[model samples]
Target: MTQQTKGKASALFPLLIFILLFIGTGVLTKDFSNMPLNVAVIIAAAVAIFMNRKVKLAKKIEIFTKGAGHENIMLMCIIFVLAGAFSEVAKGMGAVDATVNLGLSLLPANLLMVGLFLIGCFISITMGTSMGTVVALTPIGIGIADQTDIPMALAMATVIGGAMFGDNLSMISDTTIASARTQNTSMSDKFKTNFFIVLPGALITALILWFITSGSHINQLEDYSYNLVKVIPYLAVLIVAILGVNVVIVLIGGIILAGAIGIIDGSYTGTTLLQAASQGVLNMEDIAIVALFIGGIIGIIQYNGGIDYLLHVVSNKIKSKKGAEFGIAGLVSVADISTANNTISIIMTGPLAKDIASKYNVDPRKSASILDIFAACWQGIVPYGGQMLAVAGLASISPISIMPYSFYPVLLGICGITAILFGFPRRKVKQ
Candidate 1:
């Protein structure tokens, strides 16, 4: 028989300390970038290890290693590395510029904000990373704001809203991967459940942007050049992923296709292709390390009964399935708000959310959807979040300036909550 861990609120102190150290440094320094997330997690892991005197040191080390080396966690880290490599290889081959130009060239000048939003959505979905999308589109948005009557904050907010939309839905996104894996569901299954819930919000946000920018027009529009061939890899990745192919295979294929095209088009030499791939893998190092640390810390916490304590408290308050869903949403939202990174938030809250879902007989797909949606919602709007901060810095504006105009995240939060209450897109419970 398996051992049953007792609930212990004191076990959560280490997690609390990590949060305080992370958020505290950011708050005091007035710059979140000053304190690296991995550093914060390392301290938290140490605290978790040293606590609980009753457990032997040897057993604690075993628990930590087991969690760090868990199949799901290891798989997640590998995906992050592969995703980074594919993204870098694609960008090095001029895929990003080509995709951006192609989208902008086709958009109407009069509908600039709407165009930006739509293009941001498309690029972010294909890129599978919002940070990259925001970086690529913010300059374009700034130029539009300067040339036209659009407010800089509004233009930047449009980019942010669209990026968040894709970040929440993309098949290759770290947030989506973490949520789906932690909930024990497939990415395609989670995407389907997530898409329907957020579609209404996206449509509404697009319409709002259209109405706001309908009267605006650029004084002089530049004709952007693009290569259609460079765009094929992104499309293939998206399509293949949706068709339920293995994620690792899809990413590997994308890298090969992108690298081949880059080499043929003279965008990359044989040696440069290897360099780009290595750079991409290096770019993902921080997140991969953070994931390992978080896994170890969470493993320690679980061993010390922190997760059971949380489950006990949450279970006492949750009466129905809908309440249980809300509990899951709230848990992830708080984590995102605290961490300011949607992917990390999902990872931190996922194990607990899975426990809640199983106890309430909630669908794993739906639980995964809730985790991604809520995490993205808060991450998009929070001024401290990387998306908002990056866009704000690029546009030379305050992060707070972008929040009011970030309509998608607000609408998404509403839609997510409504989906929980009314159970829209209802699926028959599996027997």
Candidate 2:
């Protein structure tokens, strides 16, 4: 048996510093943009290295570098780069515009709200990012609300809810990659597990939207022109990913296909395609750097027994497998609320959740699902969260105004909690 390390409260000081620095700056400045997450993590990493004086500075640096260079962390960074490239290439080629227009063109006037939600879901799943989906669809949603009787807040909420649906279950989502890798589970497996749990919530949300908007009628219907050919890359990526192909291969193929399509359609020249790909990779630089910093900081903390202390305390309070699952859910939820970023929350909480799953005999896939679902649940509704802030900004309304109408996330939480309490979708633990 491996030797057990004693838990130490001081080991967590670095993490506390990160949270305080990140949240305090946002609160004080009333602008989260004032303190970037990567900068906060770098500061925290510095503090972690400076602490634990008995350990040689050289040894601390080694530990931090080792964590940053860990296989899973490196893989995640690579995937982020590739995902960014594909997304940017696809968008550069007009895939996002085509997809949005196609969905809008096909929607029935009576079911406009429900149609917006479904379109948001499809875009986010294919895009593998909620922020992109919200940005692409919020304007359309705002237009729909302006032309129809739908409340602006409800319309914005619908877009956010749909975006988060895919955020929780999309195979290419960073949250999926982080949760699956940290727990040593396959993306397809986690997607399947997550799909069933969130399906009920999604359906209920659709029904609720339809019920409310069924009586509403649009003042005028506008036709949006789109070329279906531009949407093939997105469809190809989604299909191949769901078929259990390797994620890295899937992303590389997507980038190539999107670039080729863009080139053939005259949407992008060779130079522009390369430039788009470069810009896409650049867009992901901050998150990728943050991931590395977080890995290093977490490594230092774990080496100093912070994680052991966390596990010891959690294991004591969590008496059953069910409780362990709840603990994982709560842990990520709090992390998401604090960071206002679901991807970062998963990165921070995944290791601890993995440990909890191992001790409680909870399926890694289930643990990953819980981590994604709960983080997404809070992310979709938190007033300060990116999704809410983006949609609220687009609608020119308060983020709090969108909260009550965020039915999908609220229902998603209910379904996730119910799955844990009832052990729904029972299956044998993977060997």
Candidate 3:
């Protein structure tokens, strides 16, 4: 019994060590970006190895290898690679510029802020990535702010909100993929469950944005030239994904189509597409590495009884389906807060959430939805998180300034709680 207790305590320690090293070092340096997350994860992984003295070094290494290469982790890594390639190729072929122009052109001057939010939402949904959406739109958002009476913080907040919205719901999104995989549900099922929960919140956010920015006007309406042909790739990806194509197939098709269009449009010649695709894959290195380390560390933690301990403690408090849902939500939120990465948080909490869901009979789809929503919420509002920092950097403003204006994440959190309290979506349990 003492041996089992020791194993559980040792298993839980690595996560705490990782948190302190990652967040603590960032706090000390006054720059979270300066500390590579991969390094901190590696450190924690090493500590995890050291703590398990009972296991031979070779066996410990074998266990870490198995976790790192687990089927789900490997699948996520493949999607990351493909998604990265698609995003870079699409950007290289001018898809982002065309999409942004097309989106902005459709809205009147009075609803420019709303247009920014919608454009962000559309871009993220199509691209299947929040970071990419923010990177592509924050500059435009800042440009609009500079040319108009709108405040910078508010403008940045709009982009962040829309980014989170798409991130929470996009079928191709890493969070969506991780959530669905972790919960052992299909992405479409999770999306269906998630959509109803957050749709009203999104609509309400748009309404509020329209009201708030109603009085603001652009100094000069900048005319943008959009090539409709360049917009086809994004539309193709979104349509295909919505049709429930295998995610890998969806991304592969996007890459090939984008490359063909770029070649025909004179946007690429010879190896340009190849080079762009390679660069895109390289961009995903950090995330891919972090995923491997997290998987391995989590494996070790589980082997040492860490996950069982967590399940025991959490399951003890779960009295009903609502409590189980809340536990899943709370677990991912705290993990995302600590890691400052929603995808990582989802991966870390996925297995444990499954256990809780199984024990309390929470619907897998709802559990997945709750995981994605809460992770997105915490990620959007946390000043230190990547989403906020990315927008803040682009707008040349403090992340703290972007916090109050993050309406979508805030509203989504409120709605998520309401859903749990009222048992929204009302799914039937599997017999």
Candidate 4:
């Protein structure tokens, strides 16, 4: 490859190696955290050096370093560290139990399950990221289950369900933007189509969750003592996030509040607070490693034109308007599973999706909705995605175990595929 052009295929080899070593090992072990992710990243980065054909040996290492050190990547790493600190510190100070009891106290015991599920949905929709919503709520959900005798899997599903709800429809969501920009459409136009299509499915999911936990016991044993004022940290984070504050600031604020509350209330010593922050940052090591390795490899792939090559190879055989649209969905869904990131899937396939949209005379809005909906649907149920990771972390359960109990994700996927086939939200072609 010339200095002006690096091929995506070659660049992507490190990513492929990482996937095989990391994800494949996790599957083989049935325990995702069995192998430390940083080790996998180190292996992948070593491979990336040899994979570079165009750039000089020195430049290849530079490319890898640059990708790993990107501003966005750095920011995410910071967020991951802060999130870890905030979560650990909060839980250590009795914040998790406090939040849980407050929720239980206000909820009707008979409808407690439904209430938790709805709250999950509400928080996700407001926040616009399934992962973010999950981090903030999953522990609380688990604590509630422990108190109320709600099944762990069933309770975990509530938060997962709600997180995906926002992921699919949030106005400022990365997936939504990726879909819209890829299809050359406005966000407002895509939302109209998506909202109508998912309405039936969302309601059905709510009903199913209600049925699953309708008889949950909310009986009183010893009422746990919780400092109501200690809950302020979580509330502050939520309010800041909802008001469009940047996520980094939100995390830092939460961390500070949690630390201060712990100290002021005698729940923790100053050194303990610092240790909690440090532990939290350490806990995110796996996630941060995954992101950096994936990004570096993906960058190489793009430089090598691997994605473009695939798109070219596939587009020739795709015939007819219907086939073209479905092909686009299939392409993006496979990418999502491979990358385990819905946002990245959309980013990779946005141009291809647009080409199909234009060639088929299909409405751009419909195409964008299809891309976002399908990716979101698959991401929701995938055991490797962030949703599962957070839920599994909270309940100490394998993601696979929760799959069967996650009626909402399964039904939403089915509902989405059916919507596509039946054209329920049929596009009205204008003359």
* Best candidate (score: TM-score): 4
- Pairs of residues at least 3 apart in sequence or in different chains that clash in candidate 1: none
Per-residue lDDT over 315-413 for candidate 1, one digit per residue giving the tens place of the 0 to 100 score: 457777899899989878866764466887788778878888888888999999999999999989976566775566556575656778989999999
Q: Model 2 off-target regions past 4 Å?
A: 1-6, 108-200, 207-222, 318-413, 416-431
Measured with C-alpha atoms, the lDDT of residue 69 in candidate 1 is: 85
Q: Candidate 4 residues 1-431, lDDT tens each?
A: 00122224454576677767767887898775675556776787678777756678787666666766766566656666667788889988889889888877777555666776676677666777776777677767778878886778777877787778778888888899889988888898898888887777778877876676677776576665767887888788777777767777888888888888899889899999999888877776666676666556555555556655455545555788777767777867766765567887888777877877787777888889888887887788766565675566546665666776776666666766776677757767544
In order, candidate lDDTs are 0.79, 0.80, 0.79, 0.73
TM-score of each: 0.66, 0.66, 0.67, 0.83
| Model 3 lDDT tens row, 368-399 | 99999999998889765656755664455656
Indicate the residue-level lDDT of 308 in model 4. Answer: 56
Q: Rank the candidates by lDDT, best first.
A: 2, 1, 3, 4
Query: lDDT at 357 for candidate 1?
Result: 89
Tens-digit lDDT track for model 2 on 177-295?
99999889999999999999999999999999999887886565656778999888867766775455666787789889989999998989999999999987887676667667877
lDDT of 4 at 364: 87
Model 1 TM: 0.66
The local lDDT score (0 to 100) that residue 99 gets in candidate 3 is: 73
Evaluate model 3: give its lDDT: 0.79
- Model 4, runs deviating above 4 Å: 1-49, 52-57, 108-113, 145-157, 214-220, 381-409
